[model samples]
Target: MIHFTPKFYLIGRVTHTGTQRDGTPFSQVWKTIDSLGSGTYGDVVLQELQGSPGGGCLHAVKSITKKAHKNNKKILTNELKALIAVKKHPTKVVTFHGWYQDSQQTMFIAMEYVSGGSLERYMRKLKRVENILISSTSPLLVKICDFGIAKSADIDASGLKT
Candidate 1:
């Protein structure tokens, strides 16, 4: 049978790609560099794909749980769809690259790494004109990263998944 093992992000030892997580197959992964922040569910790790198509570019790894409310299929579908929609935008939001799962059903979101500063940091550096006034010329541009509990959009929207 084609065993579709579930995977979620975790906070522990992750073997390099090619090894199986709990039984699911993950080829290999390099060490994490930065912390991209965490949510109620899981955390994010920053790393680089060694010798990838473009010779080792950076990537963001979102480690979430398969045991979460929506399950893997739902989460994957939503993220894939969102990525398709936002890929063309020239913003600071991370670009969706791909996904992986482990035998125990842990999922990880792989996306393009952003070299620019984060939204929080950008906002902090902005100068407040007054207590009631907010600066309109602040460099911190915010982009909404929207994902719902359900698969909000259709898969294959960008035709990249096929």
Candidate 2:
């Protein structure tokens, strides 16, 4: 239950704004909606821009305490910088939409929310259903995603952020 206090910075956002459908950002948040997934740090949610009347879109809002981020700053910084340097590729990793922070011990990173969930989970579901065809999609997508990650890294290294 990630509750964004009203005091949190509110920003206006637009969707499918430019090339590659890069979301529009008139302000920090493009839109606001009910969150869909949960993790220890934060939750993913679909949000709509304020006063846009355009509704909301899928976004993963990672909420982390300042302590947690500071503890993992080295890795996090690498990941963030790498992510920022990379171009948008659906086959690789998820896209970094935007981020927000407050005086409180909380920081939020808004990223593209892949609706299909994780590849590992998708694989498990395929096994349970015993569907060979569906099973293939997971690997294929994961590979594409891997390429995306690799593209973000230096040629010789495993890239930043394990």
Candidate 3:
């Protein structure tokens, strides 16, 4: 596993070339930065990958992983599904790029990296009380992340697991 410290950003670019399981051409240049944060399932890292072939345009990459897929397979699947569901609403949610599993059975989810810190940390930095509430019309919008414990509301009324 690739380990990086918190808030680490590279100053230069590097090329990375590899092959998928099916033997397809996979070439990308990215600056792997420090981890964004971690959750019960795994950690999220910040990266910037080349957007086009032979182009300098770089896009933010959010790399999510799980140490043991067997123990958190269900949670991983649910998080992926939830991310895909909310991907269209980029302003209100993080965008899902793609996903793949490595030889170690570790699943990697590529997503949009939001540079802003978490809402909790931002509020604390401002020296605001924890109980303070902002109105709906406030310009600032905070998104709720970490969907590991999220459940689907489309479940059947009979309480049957889907």
Candidate 4:
């Protein structure tokens, strides 16, 4: 069995420079609060900046393990490319923070921690999400995309469902 407790560990966080989500400044150290999610390669953790400017200090930190698998490398390389591509024309996304790596063979991606229930849970009673696009284009058809399982440089993913 796995045991988890609130712990603070010093790790390299690849975070965006300057103010973060809602003008929250980035802290050099972060406290691991809990596990947000996980997958075959790694997991996402909810972390709090050691000394945030003020309230709203929570941020989602994605950690991926570096293995000898060529496929993993390819996926990571593609993800990085995709991220860089978006930086030029970032849109239709949440606040994007940068990424970093620790001494351990783990790469950490820091981004805006968007808190909310699942889409299906709050879709019918939609108040926030306004509209869904309908079109013949691939972009439009790909209403849902999973960047985690992204492998191709073309931005196509495996789990394209909510």
TM-score per model over all chains: 0.56, 0.52, 0.58, 0.56
Worst 10 residues of 2 by lDDT: 127-136
Candidate 4, lDDT over the whole model: 0.50
Tens digits of lDDT, candidate 1, 41-76: 567777764454443567667777766644767666
Task: Name the lDDT of candidate 1.
Answer: 0.52
User: lDDT scores for all predictions?
Assistant: 0.52, 0.45, 0.51, 0.50
lDDT of 3 by residue, 19-101 (tens): 54576756666665566666555666666656676444333343345554445666666656666666556666655666655
Per-residue alpha-carbon lDDT of candidate 4 for residues 82-129, written as tens digits (9 for 90 to 100): 654554333344334566655565766665564542343446676423
Best by TM-score: 3
Prediction RMSDs, each to the true structure: 8.8, 8.3, 8.3, 10.6
RMSD of 4: 10.6
Model 1 weakest 10-residue run by lDDT: 128-137
Best by lDDT: 1
Clashing pairs in 3: none
In angstroms, how far off is 115's CA in candidate 2?
1.3
What total of clashing residue pairs does each candidate reach?
A: 17, 12, 0, 4
TM-score for candidate 4: 0.56
